[model samples]
Target: MAKITAAEVNKLRKSTGAGMMDCKNALVEADGDFDKAVEILRKKGQKVAAKRADRESSEGAVIAKVNDSNAKGVIVSLNCETDFVAKNEKFVELANDIAELALNCNSKEELLDAELNGLKVSEKLIEQTGVIGEKIEIGDFRTLEAPFVGSYIHAGNKIATLVGLSAQVEGAETAAKDVAMQAAAMNPVALDEAGVDQETIDKEIEIAKDQLRAEGKPEEMLENIAKGKLKRFFKDNTLVNQDFIKDSKQSVAQYVKSVNKDLTIVGFERVALS
Candidate 1:
């Protein structure tokens, strides 16, 4: 058996980001073959990943990245098993890197299959799971493309938002930013009443009517009361109807109009740790 020198162990550790003992063990197992030792370490990572396949990764980092032209953006959550690993500098960097790649990817699957330093993102994640001794993976991913895009990553990286606008106006960027922050705060269900699906609208109306009927309202009055309640629901739950965070006196739609007459939200995406 070839002796595993400290120099070889340290070299493998630097190359693979594995623990010293693991690297030494791999080197010894591979009979001091550098490539074989690296492969062994990766196999160990794969085993760890498989074992933790059912583990829930609820904590990590959220990252949002926009293109140089501001016409496209991407947001993603890189998750881990613990807050300690979530706050690691390297973990955050991994999230940022994946988000940057997501700017060009149309879907989460594509982003995972994307390559990083000759290794697919999914493979890198498994490798990271092994290095960190926990389940690490991308929890969510979304992208926005429009005439203008604005993105925000809230404090602690627990939340991220991306807003798309129909027109690129002078103040459109600021309006987009305000709307993104609004999304982070309010968690709106839809952009407007029109965007609310028929199923959800019907469900809300039914729920409202049931409550009104249970309160002894007349059957004839129940429909009208439910309609009124639905309107209130729209006002409170829709993005455009919700009061602006900065100025509660006006709706988000009114605030956007004040910024630029033609600027309007085309689409938006929000991701949270939970």
Candidate 2:
């Protein structure tokens, strides 16, 4: 075995972000070869990742990123086993990196396989799992694209949202972000009544009818009353129809229109980490 100097160990530590002791052990195992030592550390991470595969990673960072043109956006969550790891600066930075990369990835599988900082994103996650001694993985991921896009990340990185606009009109950024914040706060089930699935609509109508029947309404009145109640449900549950959180007098659609008469909401996505 080659002599492993303290300087060699520190070099490995600096490169891999491993602890001094772990770096030293890796150097010893690799006979003081820097590249070999780095590989050894990563293999250790893979083993740790395998062992923790079943652990629930409920805590981590939620990040939202938009493209340079503001024509696209993505929200991504990096999951870990504890809040301690979630709050780590490095962990948050990794989440931000992933979110930036995710702005181009259309699916979770692509994001995991995409190269990041010379390492596959999956490999990086495995490496961090070993270093942090906890499970680490990518959780929620969503992408939205339109003529204009805006994003919001709630305080504490607990929630992230993206909203797309039909046109890139004046004040579109603030309007889109306002709606994105509303999404992070309200969590509408769909962008509009049209977006709600027929099954969900039927279920809501049936539920309303049941409630009205229990209230002693005549059977003949049940259909119309239930229809009216279903409209209320849409107003409360859909994004555009819902009252603007900032000004309840106007709906979200109205608020965006107020920003620019030509601007319209195209789509939206929200990811939450509880």
Candidate 3:
């Protein structure tokens, strides 16, 4: 049997982010062969991942990152089984690193296949499951691209948002960030009235009609009254039409226009842990 030194154990622990004891055990099991020890730890991760396949991983970090030019951004949620693991400094760091990598990828599938520290993200998540002793996975992956982009992450990493603008104006960063914060706080259902799906529109109208009927509104006026209520829904639930949280006197669209007449909110993406 090969004698495992403390240096060997620390090296494996550093490389795998596994606990010192786990690394030492893997090293011992592998007869002090570093490569074999890594394999053993990875196999442990696979076993843990498969065993916890049905576990709920609703708690994690929501991270947002943008490219150097600020023309593109992404929000990624690195989910774990508990808030304790989610808030771990190393876990959040991994999430931020993955978010940075995600800024270059178009979709979750691509991001998973992308390599991080010589390991594919999907593999890293599996490895982390063993290290964390909990399910670790990506819950949300969203991207936005425009002439300019900005992002915001709410306290506790509960919410993350990205906003894109029509042009890279003077205040584009500030405008985009403000809109992103608005998205995080207001939780708009759609970017605009036009963006709201017909199904949702119908449902809101139907709900309004029922409420009005309960109030004993004349049945003949139901259609018009429902339309009015739908308009109100648009005003409150859509990003551009919603009242600006900072200044209730104006809508989000107006606030963006005030920054620069040519600046417009082209798109946005939001991701939350819940």
**Which candidate number maximizes lDDT?**
3
lDDT of 1 by residue, 29-81 (tens): 99999999988988888999999999999999999999999999999899999
Candidate 2 lDDT for residue 56: 94
Off by over 4 Å in 1: 1-11
All candidates in order of lDDT, best leading: 3, 2, 1
Per-prediction TM-score: 0.93, 0.95, 0.98
- For model 2, how does the per-residue alpha-carbon lDDT over 1-274 read when each residue is reduced to its tens digit? 8998989988877667789999999988988888888899999999999999999999989999999999989889999999988999888988998988998899999999998877899998988888889999999988888999999999888899999999988899889889999998999999998999999999999999899989999999999999999999999999999999999999999999899887889899999988
lDDT of each: 0.90, 0.91, 0.94
Instruction: Enumerate clash totals for all models, in the order shown.
Output: 0, 0, 0
Q: Output the TM-score of candidate 1.
A: 0.93
Top-TM-score candidate index? 3
* Candidate 2 accuracy as TM-score: 0.95
Ranking of predictions according to TM-score? 3, 2, 1
